[model samples]
Target: MNALAAQALISARRALHQRGELAVRVAFYAIILVIFSALWSAAAGANGGSISGYDAHSLLWYVAAAEGSVIATKPRMIESIGWDISSGAIVTEMLRPASVVGLRLAAELGEALVRLVCSLAVGGVIVWLYVGQPPSAAGIALFVPASFLAVGCNLAAQHAFAGAAFWLRDARSTWFLYQKLVFLLGGMLLPLEFLPTALADVARALPFASMAYVPARLASGHVEPWLLLVQAAWLAGLLACAGGVFWAGERRLEVVGG
Candidate 1:
């Protein structure tokens, strides 16, 4: 546990020092938020000034919240994990921790938490200036837990997907497909409500919605206690899936005399 914590801190500091790259990513994050907010605002204007329980102001805020957590991630999490496995780095990492997966997760978490804070700060400022006011105090309070779970669930799923590298020797294609799934089913660009009725239902049933939509929706002031429960359940399930995949991968390596 202490080792994991130290790894997280070291990763965080390393990420913090890469000011140029982090600045560019945060700028890109800000730009995407602005573009989406504008598009939603125009749509609302063309309609009756609101659509599907979302007005221009609230819609902007929603996009900010949704994308904030969604964008606060390692861009090549799955692909990098795959590369580590294929290059035999995972084997070396296994010597440092009882499980390579736990160490990698700890490192990623440290880096991601910093990025999450920066992304959320940019998002909050954008929405506040454009929309005039943020969500209610209670909604703001709940957003932290909801968004934390959102990030956790996403990372867990990515780790599970990365296990494909153990067998396939490549995770790029898998990463591509998984990203699209998150972009659609996870509602990274838009809320689940924007999806078709059937599609929305499926998204809700899956873990994807727990990644972005739940926290975003809650931050928009339509807090539902049940959605948090849904996020918790999915987090548990995805963590299990990740653990299972890595456990099997380790066994595979051992059997192969790696």
Candidate 2:
């Protein structure tokens, strides 16, 4: 890769490593897992039987995989774009030799990878202690491709949202709304299978499913291999659409005074 891309990756990695907020973010994920584990265990016991076809082990594994995927695909792009706009840093960045989108993409990917590692380590421990080990090695191997596609789709969706900063002076509200919708519709907290048939159909059709639901479902062995290919296709389509949005935004771009 060129020096610009290399520098972007270095800078992104450094930013995530040195940021004081890293601890807080890790703690947040751990706390969430603990809370959910307690709640799920209580409910499972009360039900006097399996809860939603999930034993404690399966439920915990699903939680770990789902949370890991979320951390892996967070919308750091929106935050970066907002900061650049508000501080008038876009002008300086635009003058650099690197492509702004390319640099941001590299940087955000680095950050996401860092967060994923931390989340998996911390979350994995929590799940192990409370629930037990994950599924067999084969199951984990099957999840690999789906997990990568999920992360890719997440990055594309976030960048697409961030591209809106080109026109809007303040995109924070939109960003917040998008995050909420993604978490809910993507089935981060509950499997989409639990949704009504019509709702589940719509959710599956949207790119959101490729973010968390599909990967988690695959990890849980709930999804068929044929459906895995469908998920990959959806991810590919979304990435293309996101690229088009980025190009269009760049074409119309004019950096306004902060």
Candidate 3:
């Protein structure tokens, strides 16, 4: 545990050292939010006071929450794992007195924490400019835990997918597929409430919804304890699945040369 904390701090400092890149990423976040705000405003105007359950203002906020969640965790774990496998770095990591998966997860959590702050800061500015108000304090408080759990859920899913690199020698295809699933079913571009009832129910049953939709909804003042409970369940299941994959992948690991 102590070693994991130290690794997390090291990763956080590494992210801090990449401040220039983070600044550029934050700029892109602001631009995307602005574009979404305009599109939502036009749609709301065309449809009347509100489109679905969200007014223009609340819709923008919802989107901000959703986009912020997306930006916060960029799924770099897959690429990192793939690289470690292909480059034989996993062997070196295995020698360390720590669980490789746990260490990487802690590091990713550190990176995600830093990204979440930067994204939220940029998102907060855009929300103020376009929506003119902050999310409810109570809502933000509730969202913090859910969002953290969402991060863990995301890591588990990514680790499970990335474990394929041990066999495929590359996990880019898996990552791409997962990205599309998250974009379409995780409510990155639109709230699940806006989806057809049947479609929304299907998506809700999947892990993707727990990452983006549930957290965003909670942040937008939609309190649902059942959603949080479901997210926790998903987290536990995903973690177990990840651990199983890790064990299998490690067993299959073979290095051809130094």
lDDT (10s digit) by residue, model 1, range 1-258 = 588798889998988998887888889999998898789999999999988888888788778888888787877889889988888888887776456777777788888878888889988988888887765667777888999898888888999989988887788767778878888898877788888999999988988888888888888877677888999999999988999999999889889845
10 residues in a row with least lDDT, candidate 1: 93-102
Candidate ranking (lDDT, best to worst)? 1, 3, 2
How high is the lDDT of residue 140 in model 1?
70
lDDT of 2 at 39: 75
Q: What lDDT would each prediction earn against the true structure?
A: 0.84, 0.71, 0.79
lDDT of 1 at 24: 83
Error of 3 at 149 (Å): 1.7
* lDDT (10s digit) by residue, model 3, range 1-258: 598898889888888789987887788888888899899999998998687777787777777777777777665657778878767678787778877788878888788878877888779777878777755677767777877777778878888778777777876556677877887799878888888999998998899988888778877767676778988999999888877876677767643342
Cα misplacement distance, residue 182 of candidate 3 (Å)? 0.9
C-alpha root-mean-square deviation, candidate 1: 1.3
What is the lDDT for 204 in model 3?
A: 86
TM-score of 1: 0.96
Model 3 lDDT, residue 177, Cα: 78
Greater-TM-score candidate between 2 and 3:
3
Candidate 3 deviant stretches above 4 angstroms = 254-258
> Which parts of model 1 are misplaced by more than 4 Å?
none
